[model samples]
Target: MNRNRAKWLTLMTLVLLTLTMSAQNKQKFKVVLDPGHGGKDTGTNHLKNVEKDIVLAVALEVGKILNKESDIEVFYTRSKDVFVPVKERSVMANEAKGNVFVSIHCNGVASSSPSGTETYVMGLSKNKSNLEVAKQENSVILMEDDYKTQYAGFNPSAPESIIGLMLIQEDYVQQSIDLASRVQDGFTYDLKRKNRGVKQGPFWVLHGAFMPSILIELGFVSNKEEGAYLSSSKGQKELAKSIAQGIISYKNAYYNNGIAHTETNVNEPQANTKSAVKGVTFKIQIAASSRVLALKPQNFKGLSNVTMEKGKKINKYFYSETSDYTEAKQRLAEAKAKGHSSSFIVAYKNGKQIPLEEALK
Candidate 1:
């Protein structure tokens, strides 16, 4: 090769290698640390004081540690004692391109006996207490009229509470769950606190976040002992360290596995709301020895409007009313898609099961 061509080739190769290394070294973890209820809005207060101060102290310490210890860039919603509305915090974090958001708060209940660390992610709640807690936490939105717009139009009622969660529609759901689990474990093992498993519910602060977000209630302020621990400097350091480590460990798993793609989120509910079609009457089974003629009127007189279809090696039954022609066709389509052609209904009339004829009228 000519000297000029050889020199150009060497330069091009060096340029390509540099770009590749830069892409590989790009930051994999970007976190937003939110200390719940600041300034005038002192969330839930104990005899010692409000939860706002406790969470801020912990969040500040956590952010400092994350910045000093790891390559992760931690964004804070508030750095000092100031009121940051729910809408503003979410907007600021998203603007900063945060990948994950962690909201820190202290749990509270009327009874001084209740104590534990509960972590919440956006979703529907099933329990009454959980629903109440959701409402209490979510009320922070009242401070902002545009909170609805801030969270990408998340509806507190019906489906809106669940649908807006689609933005994170990637593998982050499981990753968020894993991080929450680790934090709970850390609280139990390292901090000697009660562990509440990762829970799903609607939180105003989390509803609009485009990335994986979690709200952590680190022990009940209602309980005297727990409140005291949360107020102390040593307890603050311990709590912050445990939470930061959980995030580090979780992010390490993804980076270690070389997972560059985001996870898909299944936010929408399925159209088929589970029906309450009860009773053994709903189930129709056939006998192993039953023949196609078993579907005949005289053979199965008591059975009403039974439909049957000839199977490759067996017969199938269907209920003329509930499992009508249209439903049968849809199920057949689903079965065919799954490579299963033996998709048919079997009816149980009396004690015998009719096969081919039993599945059809």
Candidate 2:
């Protein structure tokens, strides 16, 4: 009887300690690194340099740096020269409950004049250049068996096919944009590379990822000088270090219980004449651009109540405001009718933008 009681007490004590430890420890941030293209699918073959080999080397180097950080847990879709389906890559990230998914690739073009890095988040883009990039990347889906069945109605060559298929990632759009902006800053400022800026495009690899995801086009492999640098050991090391720094910065800002930092406009006046309102507000986001425009109705297609919010790298213009959700939807239609075709309704709690669904709830 004494022996049995002692055994039961020991088991209960271990269980209590496990529960306490689990409660005290926070979950580690998991990042999924995917190196694009491999095996028979040599991404872009420029003379002796191959895109697959370059990206793989960079991705491994990034993993090496991130692995030393105690707060982050890193996973690779493919650490070797093997091909993994795009859908499978996202699935692996999802299965791991990753916080972010980063797909790395090298850009190629017929002309070697364009030499810059661009990071992409999943969304339908109207820009012809953005569509072309999406098309080039989406064509990889064709290499998979039963891709037509797998992707359903998605046509790699048709930009219209991706219009209504981005609902799954809408909730994560802001988060993905935040990370992309950081990565672009690292490329431009830290590595002294030309920044092509963050863009939105229909990347199939990013669509299925449940968390914040981005596809990075490192640089143009067709440009001879850039290609030589990209294929070299020193360049790869620098690129990897820059990328790792960006990821670390983002993690510190987002997952360390810190507030998202915004840049302050130095020239703007700090005087507040109006009293702060205390309810949820909705606005129609008409445009987001790197350039700041004059805040006049004539500048934004006769939209009278145009307001601009400056972010770290871009300025967003919101047209009209309403406290009602239905009225906000109507305002979105109005903005779209006035040539702001990409306009959407955004919700704000107090002053900060909150998720539309959460605000509605």
lDDT of each: 0.64, 0.80
True-structure RMSD, every candidate: 16.3, 9.8
Cα lDDT tens digits, model 1, 180-199, are: 76677788888788876677
**lDDT score, candidate 2:** 0.80
Local distance difference test, candidate 1:
0.64
Question: Residues 1-361, candidate 2, lDDT per residue (tens digit)?
Answer: 9999999999999999999777546467788999998877778877567999999999999999998987788999999999888789999999988988999999999897989999988877777888898888888888998898998967888767755556567657766776787898899998899889888888889989998899999998999999999999999999999889888866764564112222110111124411222377978777765557999989989888899998645568889888866566677778867877546666688788764544544
Per-prediction count of colliding residue pairs?
Answer: 23, 0
Which residue pairs show backbone clashes in model 2? Answer: none
Q: Stretches of candidate 2 above 4 Å error? A: 1-19, 22-26, 257-306, 310-361
- Candidate number of the best lDDT: 2
What TM-score should be assigned to candidate 1? 0.64
Which structure among the candidates has the greatest TM-score?
2
Where in model 1 is the C-alpha error above 4 Å? Answer: 1-6, 9-13, 16-20, 23-28, 145-171, 256-361
